[model samples]
Target chain A: MRGKYLLGILVILGALGYMVFGGLGRNLVYFLTPSEYLQDQARYQNRSVRLGGLVKPGTVQYDKDRLELRFVLTDGVAEVPVLHKGTPPGMFKEGQGVVVEGRFQEGVFQGTNLLVKHSEAYQAPKEGWTPEEVRKLIEEAQ
Target chain B: MLKTQTPSRPDALTWVFLGLGLLLLPLGLYLALAAPPDVNQGYLVRIMYLHVPTAWVGYLAFFVTFLYSLLYLFRQDPRHDRVALASAEIGLVFMGLALVTGMLWARPTWGVYWTWEPRLTTTAILFAVYLGYFLLRGAIEDPELRRKAAAAVGVLGFLNVPISYMSVKWWRSLHQTQSIDLTTGRIHMDPAMLQALLFNLLVFTLLYLGFTRFRAMVAALEEAKEEA
Candidate 1:
């Protein structure tokens, strides 16, 4: 009976230890914004990191191979040039948020791939509205 | 009326296992502290010392469940069924530790807390399926039926363990592959670190056995009380 009680106590203690120390296991990666990365550039240089921001307008350029691409990722304050070797996703466009993973080399962020983030407010077009009607409504709202 | 008393004999195997567990603590500590940091990953790689051992022991516990579940099905012994259930509970605890430690290690290395990588996702599913085993056992009232249902789940859940381990190799995943192979005695680590990891593995295995046996004993006692 005493042995059983001791076992119960040990199990309870183990459970409690898990609850307290478990956070160390869960939050392994800390997210950083563009400005945060810039502020700590010296410490983070040459290390693998993730950069997330909007694809700056008028900065996208595609190569002859159609697979190689370049774009500028901006967080309104500064823009970082990105060179990617793979094909960009369909939703990857100007003014869209994207997260790229790679190392920062020679002041340029060379990304291996791009993940395009879609907005939550996407709405389907009304069934009754024709293109002409929708154009008129847009004109009136503007 | 008086009850008859029989001579009680202590289980020597349990004591030996417990001694082995005690001996491992210092070795695991030595490995964690003595090994030089990795040239590329640095101190973060030390997390592997604890994480890998926990994962291995979790797999060991599940294997025990699979064997006992088969025994229960063939022999129709409630004792084997109780042992299987107790082992599953312990297995869940160790698996939870593995998942948590994997996440902690990933954050400093992978640049994200969670990813949709194949290995990580499959392990997560494996954890959930085993958790469901406990819930299913609780919801059923008939003891015989519960044993049959739980045995089926135990067998099926064990099948996922291998798939989780191999998912990294079989699919595209950001998670890294296994770093050490014990069978070939081929390990890539600072000598001190390898020693620490092996020590911790032994300690954790002892802890797993101790807990499972204790849990089984408690389960048996509870059943005896119910029968009374």
Candidate 2:
């Protein structure tokens, strides 16, 4: 009985200690905005971290090959330039929310991957209406 | 009918284990912090000292659970069931530590806290599966059924552990593969940093043994109360 009891206590304490002081404890996750990235430029110079926010309007520039792409990520206060050497997601566009993954290098946010936030709202076509009928009904309603 | 003699508690062994743990703390601290940074990755490499060991111990804890869970099912002893439950709980805690540390390490190394890559996704799934193990235990009222059901799930859930570890090599992903290769016996690290990691691993393993023993004791007491 005593043997079992000792085992139980050991397991619990071990788990707690591993979480609190272990290497895992030191590297807990935190998010950074574009403004914070800019404000702490010197501090974050070469460190890798996630930068999340909306894509700045009119900042997206895509090469004809669709492989090399450029855009600006913004948190409303500041904008950071993003360069990706991959195909952008179909849903990726200007003014959309996006998160880029890569290190900050030479004043650019080089993204190896891009994740585009999809809109949730859904609009239904009018009941019993064809494409032409829908146009005619909109004109009649106006 | 003759009564069997009760096994004596190994007080000396317990003291020895505790002493070893105390000695390990200073050595682990030195290796984790006092050691110089790597010439390549710099200080961020230090995270490996903690993350890797936590991951190793998490697997060890779960393996204990799997073994004890089988014992409970086959022997139908409540003592075995208690030990299995205690191990599972400890395993969950270590798994959480591994995930948290992995995220922290990722922030500086991989540049993101979360990703849908194979290893990350599978690890998240492993965490959720164990979490579901606890929830399943809570949902059941019958002690015998709870033990059997949880044991089955425990065995099945462990199947993902290897998958999580190997996903990086199996598929292309942004997540970095393992740092150490046992067959090659070559560590891509400075000698001092390697020493630190090895020291920390020993300390964490000792710490793990001590904690597991303590938790098992508490579980035994709880079982005795239930039986009484």
DockQ for candidate 1: 0.02
True contacts kept of 1: 0.00
Stretches of candidate 1 above 4 Å error? Answer: A1-142, B1-12, B182-186
TM-score of 1: 0.61
Ten consecutive residues with minimal summed lDDT in candidate 2 chain A?
A117-126
Per-residue CA lDDT of candidate 1, range A18-45, in tens? Answer: 5325522331332345787898899878
Q: List the global CA lDDT of all models.
A: 0.70, 0.68
Q: What are the per-residue Cα lDDT tens digits for candidate 1 across B1-228?
A: 243232132256756776777777677767676555543344556778778888988888888999999999999988899889999999999999998998887665554566655677667767766776776676666889989988998898898788778765565345655557433445555555566777788789897897787777777777666566
Residue B161 of candidate 1: its Cα lDDT? Answer: 87
Reported per model, the fraction of native interface contacts reproduced equals 0.00, 0.00
CA lDDT of B159 in candidate 1?
Answer: 86
lDDT of 2 by residue, B179-222 (tens): 56554554555566677777877877777776776666676666
* Chain B TM, per prediction: 0.89, 0.88
